[model samples]
Target chain A: MIIANTLADGFVVFLTEAHSWTNDITKGAVAETDEQAESLLTAAKQAEQTNVVIDPYLIPINIEDGLRKPTEYREYIRATGPTVPIPS
Target chain B: MYRYDEFDARLVTERVEQFRRQAQRRLSGELTEDQFKPLRLMNGLYLQLHAYMMRINIPYGALSSKQMRQLAHIARTYDKGYGHFTTRQNIQYNWIQLKNVPDALADLAAVEMHGIQSSGNCIRNTTSDQYAGVARDELEDPRVYCEIIRQWSTLHPEFSFLPRKFKIAVTGSPNDRAAVKLHDIGLRMHQNEQGKTGFEVIVGGGQGRTPFVGKTIRDWLAPEHLLSYLEAILRVYNLDGRRDNKYKARIKILVHQIGTDEFRRLVDTEWQQIKDGALNLPQSEIDRINAYFTPPAYAQIDDETESLNEQRTQNPAFDAWVQANLAEHKVSGYSIVNISLKSPKLPPGDVTAVQMDALADLADEYSFSELRVNHRQNLVLADVPQKDLLSLWTKLIELDLATPNIGLISDIIACPGLDYCALANARSIPLAQEIHQRFQDIDKVHDIGELTINISGCMNACGHHHVGHIGILGVDKRGKEFYQFTLGGSSDQNASLGDRTGKGFPADEAVNAVEKILNTYIMVRNDGERFLETYRRVGMKPFKEALYGSA
Candidate 1:
């Protein structure tokens, strides 16, 4: 799956089936095979031209029980907000 | 705080208009990301992991109450209702949208603050001792020259773009709270044999992938030759610093590869040409800048204090805050108050808008409507009257800013880490939180006394892990979070970099090492000795032994 953030306001997003960015990773489009992931990336790269989302890139994730989850701790944090609640 | 002059004011306003257009162009797709990246960085707008981050330079760390209140307003209105006071003596709003930053910059400029030179490969903010004017042991107020440098470096045609970013820090005191030796250019004020005040210029020092203590380029430089000499050194670096590799582009790398002696000779050769040129500042200009920093008229205060002493006896908590956070003021009956941002729950250096507003109010009531951002990720009410210390402490406690862990073990200095920074390899805040929880007893922490534990998320060393008495650098080892420890580092005038323990601990077990080390210190320390003193006297051998157990 590929991850990106909306350039308009930095909302966490995942590239979906319609080549659109969504907040839900479960709804994230699966580009399984290497060729498919490459082809999907080609579509994701076009989002940068629209200037809607910034720096769309791939994140290594596993399909764990019907949910897409990041393989690394750091990337998981990028998917969510901070691990701790920020000050009020 | 130094007020902007007509020239300064005009320049900032014009720059704001320029950036507003540029941001609009980028949004309208007139400028591509590649083209706009440098432009945005030059304006202190960074595309961090989460959102656009804006760095606002608080020149020499001084802020008038009015300017600080303006910052609070910005935080509440445009940002995430908070600002992060950085180790560079600047404030960063981490959640800025691209559209809001132009307005944010304009807000900052209205109060004589701007983000210009706060980012990009430029001479960044010139940080100074937070207690610059009020330091009892200070030989001269460093901010006088700090303001002078701020003017000289702002929008300089010659140094608008260098091989890499440059930093300069100034200190007037012998105690070196400014961490001068860690800057690209560190200037320590001193007196010559004739008792003429000048500077001890240390050049080519920085922290990032490579960290080194700056070498003293000139033993002493006369005040008149300051700007000329600095221009010469910068010119040499601009001409010689590597551009091929960003990692090796800093002046520190150039100084190392060519040797400081050779670099000094080259700079001096350039200096000889410009020594008495237009850049040589006249005392008239120096005096004008000095006039801005003249001490506020303080009321006649008693040399010996009774009220504060009685308060200390009556309230132990207030006394603890006084003992841990207050510094000796040059004025006999004044105290420099340090308001710690390292609370038990919040992130270090994070101050909310409400907290900022409260601080502004507190400053008005007690500190002559002035405050300073300390390099240790804290705030300073630099001129609080000794008699008002208790009152200020009470107010601070209500605001949750009264963390009595100033230089103690719980006073951890940490970077935003993986939480906010795009460059971080591991999370720093969680580890810092764990340690703060582990060392929860204030009495024990105060007893541990004056131990600095700095944490960095990566080798960039934004947390200054290299100079911590005990350092924790978070590392990602084969996809798992691990922390590497270092010992015997000090950021004092007598500075020393920490030695790595050659040990790594799991994320949760990192606090175990700290506990064992503190316990060891408790057994071995001599009376009246701080952590670094005991570490220096005993050496890292004992610490290594205590931490890892004979291997």
Candidate 2:
């Protein structure tokens, strides 16, 4: 799973699976449980109007994935903070 | 020195015309910013923060005085009368107007130089040793192979829209001054046990967010298989390199994920398919390209050791300059002189139009009408005669080019950073200036000995911080600037990526930290050792202890 949030016009937050490629249980259809992933998938699909097709299985899993129970094989985005920041 | 024959000339001219049309269309608002962005990038016109930036190729870092003068002319006429030489051995004009880009292309094309493939996700300018032909330890002139690759890769159709940008560097010299190890693909010209000259190909070495030293994929790749092998690598990267994430788009990440052995196997399979294809590089074409880089005719002269010794004894400054700037040349009575662009108070690698013209004049007068833009961002007069050393040094000093700090602590490699580059997170130039000011004392710098302190504005590694003996990477902490330091890195033959020396430091404290580190090295060094030698012997422990001190 890969998710990106547009902080600025040029700046984007890219998220991917920590260990391996994500499984697309929903296939071409959207997951009914999430709104953020659906919106991102729509945007991504629009962006891929040209011949260069974005892999449909590799949908953005932002809201659902974050809300789900954390696991060892979970996704990790290079967020704008230390992975383990020491307390000042 | 690779003169464009009819085919090359036609292609370049056509490219200029094509860019001219594109520029005209964009000006007429026929193309939007998004639409025109790729087109301009294809022509090497980048929309930087302030203005349009133009990157001009210095094919394999080799340039004639005529071509250099053209660059100088571009700087004076089209830009802000200064040019920034990049780590990739290309020069960037930061203040180019979109209206004048077409004219700039035509001007560059007039000198057999074009910005083609300088940007875009295509094969870029093939860089080699600045002293490629003239270096003493070179197996052969690497420029010959560079030129050949240039021809093969120029506007290569299939590989144009790869996963991301691809860079290839070749080095004939044993020293590896070209930083071949840090490139997407590095080719070191070598002779196998059979005494047959070929390349030792290393793949997937790059430094951005993820820094990796390229692994040797092929111990020996014959000259004939160069293009085919490169195609294979590109094909593998193009097919499998991550396209979803821009950060993970580099071949290095792909190679890392796939593992070197698996990647090599895939490349080998690809190579088996494409080997001895049309891109096999015909013998006649090779000969044609080789002809351009043929060594200039020289009048045999005895080494002026006695006179040089007399001058060295008389002038301490000259002696220091000679020690730092002079490089051993293939010819006995000649030497390559590095005119340091990293003068104190001046932005590192910022050469003014006047300096460029002066270097052009010096190149014509002192060298065989040749100048080289080194990977260190210094200009080189590769064939300066032994007798003219004093006079040349005097002239260079007058032009503020004789810093006598080449390969010293003050001789820093710095990118424009936030000062000029839009992508930069923090200001690298100011940091470099601060460091340069700190080490302006010549005596202290000399005592510190041969050290390369490379600074990059961002993790793009445009300044090649990963390979620096003391690497400083600028990072943005919130709105404030912070710098991360790395130790014990080298770009030479035994190339290795630097180890991160703990946490990042604030911009103001970075130089002080560096000073502390250097002071520790000076104290602990065994028997007049260089900075790298000491760092190697002691590892990072002593330096870390000195820097942090039981924090």
Residues B16-111, candidate 2: write the lDDT tens digits: 899888877766656655677798898888765445689988888888889888998998888879888888889998778777888888988898
TM-score of each: 0.98, 0.86
Error of 2 at B454 (Å): 0.7
Q: Where does model 1 exceed 4 Å of error?
A: A63-66
How much of the true contact map at the interface does candidate 1 reproduce, as a fraction? 0.61
Chain B TM-scores per candidate, in order, are: 0.98, 0.98
RMSD of each: 1.4, 10.8
| Docking level of model 1 | medium
lDDT of each: 0.89, 0.80
DockQ of each: 0.71, 0.02
Runs in model 2 with CA error above 4 Å? A1-88
